[model samples]
Target: MEHAGKHALVTGGGSGIGKGIALALAHAGAEVTITGRRADTLATAAALHPRLNALEMDVTDEASVREGIAAAAALRGPVRICVANAGIAEGGPFAQTTLADWRHMMATNLDGAFLTFQAALATLGDDDAARMIVVSSIAGVRGLKNAIPYTVTKHGVIGLIRGLSEEYMRRPITFNALCPGYVDTAIVRGQLPGLMRRFDVDEQGAIDIIAKGNRHRRLLQVDETTGAAMWLCSDAARSVNGQTIEISGGQV
Candidate 1:
């Protein structure tokens, strides 16, 4: 129970990698608040674990984020660990991507993290050790072929963490980003059918296409990314800050 009595907040915690990380934190004994836009989903996720609490939050809206975090913190305690995991992964050719699409990605992926980190920091004590983990992607570090919007938003998240890390260099809080490639999540599963339709291939072929995004040509289970998140929130990583821990099979 290393995280006993700690209040951990995870955005987008209804499913996929976010759900995995929330469960990990709860298992480690933290009072977990899982936030998402869907109340039903949040409730369902919360039902799965006694330590998990559900909060309906639209991270894209600054007011919603601020209000949601404040409410959660008031109910549990100061947010000692925050997982900014809410994001959308949409891919299209640059010429086909619209301004609305770009803005949507930026709103949820970039602005959401900024608002979440700021609000969580406000609840943290000056002398307390805290963790802010932004769930970025390998695309954050390097460009992807047709995911321009996702790439840009992820890069922005890395920049957010880097800037915050430097600004709080002397503080007890640590900022970091987790860059995972092709994790086996609902987001990736949603792409399989599209890939099949686009390439006229079978399910395996579509899966292989997504898996090839990683250097090892395999899809990572959500647990793999969760492990990295757990480490970032652990005491062992006290000295690790302003770092992007890449979970791709190999270097991009």
Candidate 2:
């Protein structure tokens, strides 16, 4: 019960890494509000824990984010832990990427985090201790091949945290990011078919190719990322701000 009585809001908590972290926060005694664009998906995740609640929110839209977070705060309390985890992962060669594709990536990955953090922060009082986290990809720290738009959005969120951390240093809030490499999420699984077709390899071969991107040469589990999130929300990590915790099993 490390997070007893606090309200933690996790965007994209309907599935994958977001769901995992929401459940963990609920287990730690926080009133967890999981938000996403899908009402059914959010309901399914909310049903997993007694402390978990569902909120349908579209992060890409400024109005949706502001209203949804306000509703969440009214239901529970001011958000003490804000996890901006809602994002899409679509990758293609830089030359083939259309302008719409780049715009969509920026809207969802970079702008979504910006809207979420801003809305959540607005709910907190001057003295309330809060933690704002962005779920970035390893591509944020380094370039990713054939994923120009995705890499740029991920890097943009890192810049968001770095800037917010400095600006809010005098306050009781902290801003940080998580950079994980090749986690076994639905997004990663969806890319396998493309990899198989492009490389003319079997499904397993494509999986192996993806896993090779990680330093450990294996796919990371949801719990690995959840554990890091739990630690960052704890009292021990109060001073650990403006940093990106890389969960790639080793150096990127």
Candidate 3:
């Protein structure tokens, strides 16, 4: 449950689940590197903890990921924990989904995980132990109406982790995915206005509508997901590989 001197890297660590995980790891005494496209946001999150360091990197860009990880490793050490949590969730009618929207989702969610894992793995030596966690969604395990592209990307990341776990079965690294349901995140909050407009309801009404999607009919706290990520990083989960830890209220 403790990581005294480990080096952990979390993408999209500026806010929400990613930020929560980064802060938790830092509190556990790990030298944490948090990366995001926004420097200001990253800095704000990093400032919350002395163990947290901010790194500006776009998960969608290959060169950025490679260089950013290398720089982080140089400063902190080889990454022992890598969390690929950078993604966007945009819901729209399937018929109205353009190719551009599909590509953007694919790039940020699926491709971002691929690049982050590849680059972080490169920092580890043959004998080094590492944990790779992907922050997918509940939509990954089932079809989500009106969110075809987002669901596809989430599912794609789950596949990426599964294949990677098998491919590196003999290695000291473990690959896993965390599929969480609707949480009280900025992403969820951002969708509230749209939901209100579409449903002709108030803010609280929109939130209630979204909460109904979860089996518990509630918006989960960020700590719920962060706790799972912290457990996967612990020694107890060393054998937990090629698995998906669903954080939804119940099975989808």
Candidate 4:
């Protein structure tokens, strides 16, 4: 029970990488609050773990995030660990990307993490140890062709973590980011059809196109990312702040 007595909050915990992290935290004895826009999905995910609780939160809205996180902290004690894993993955050429598209990506991927971290920091005690992990993507490190909006949003998230890490350098809180490449998640599955349509390719070709993003040419399992999150949240990682741990099978 490495996380015993710790109250952990995971945004976008309804499915995929967030769900994996939530389950791992619960198993480690933390009182976990799983947040998502979909109440039904949150409830279903919470049901899977006895220590996990569900909260309805729209990370894109400041008011909702402030209220929802406050309520969760009241119920589960101060939040010592927070995972900002909620994001949308949409891709298009920079010229073809609309203003609305850029705003949507920023609101969910970048703004969401900002709101979540702010609310979570309010609950942390001065002497208590804490971890804030932002789920960024490999796109944050390098630009992805035809994914200008996503790349920009991810880069923003990494910047948020780095700035926060420096601001809290003297404090016990550690801020870091995880940059994973093409994880086998529902989000990737949703992109397959779009990939096929855009490239005029079959299903295998569509899959291959994404798999090639990783050096090993295979989709990473959700557990791989979860393991990295768990390590960062552990007491042993006290000195590992302001770093981006990439899970792209090799150096990016």
214 Cα displacement, candidate 3 (Å): 0.6
Off by over 4 Å in 3: none
Q: What does candidate 4's lDDT look like per residue over 6-43, in tens digits?
A: 99999999999999999999999999999999989999
- What does candidate 4 score on TM? 0.97
lDDT per residue, candidate 2, 1-252, as tens digits?
989999999999999999999999999999999999999999999999999999989989999999999989998999999999999988878999999999999999999999999999999999999999999989999999989999999999999999999999999899999999999999899989988999999999999999999999999999999999988998899999999999998998
Candidate 3 residue-wise lDDT at 36: 98
lDDT of 3 by residue, 1-252 (tens): 388889999999999999999999999999999999999999999999999999999999999999999999998899999999999988889999999999999999999999999999999999999999999999999999999999999999999999999999999899999999999998899999988999999999999999998899999999999999999998899999999999889878
How high is the CA lDDT of each candidate model? 0.94, 0.95, 0.94, 0.95
Determine which window of 10 residues in candidate 2 has minimal summed lDDT: 88-97
| Number of the top-ranking candidate, with lDDT as the measure | 4
Candidate 1 ranges with C-alpha deviation above 4 Å: none
Candidate 2 local Cα displacement, residue 74, angstroms: 1.0
Q: Give the C-alpha miss distance for residue 53 in model 4, angstroms.
A: 0.6
Q: What is the lDDT of residue 123 in candidate 4?
A: 94
Per-model clash counts, in order, read 0, 0, 0, 0
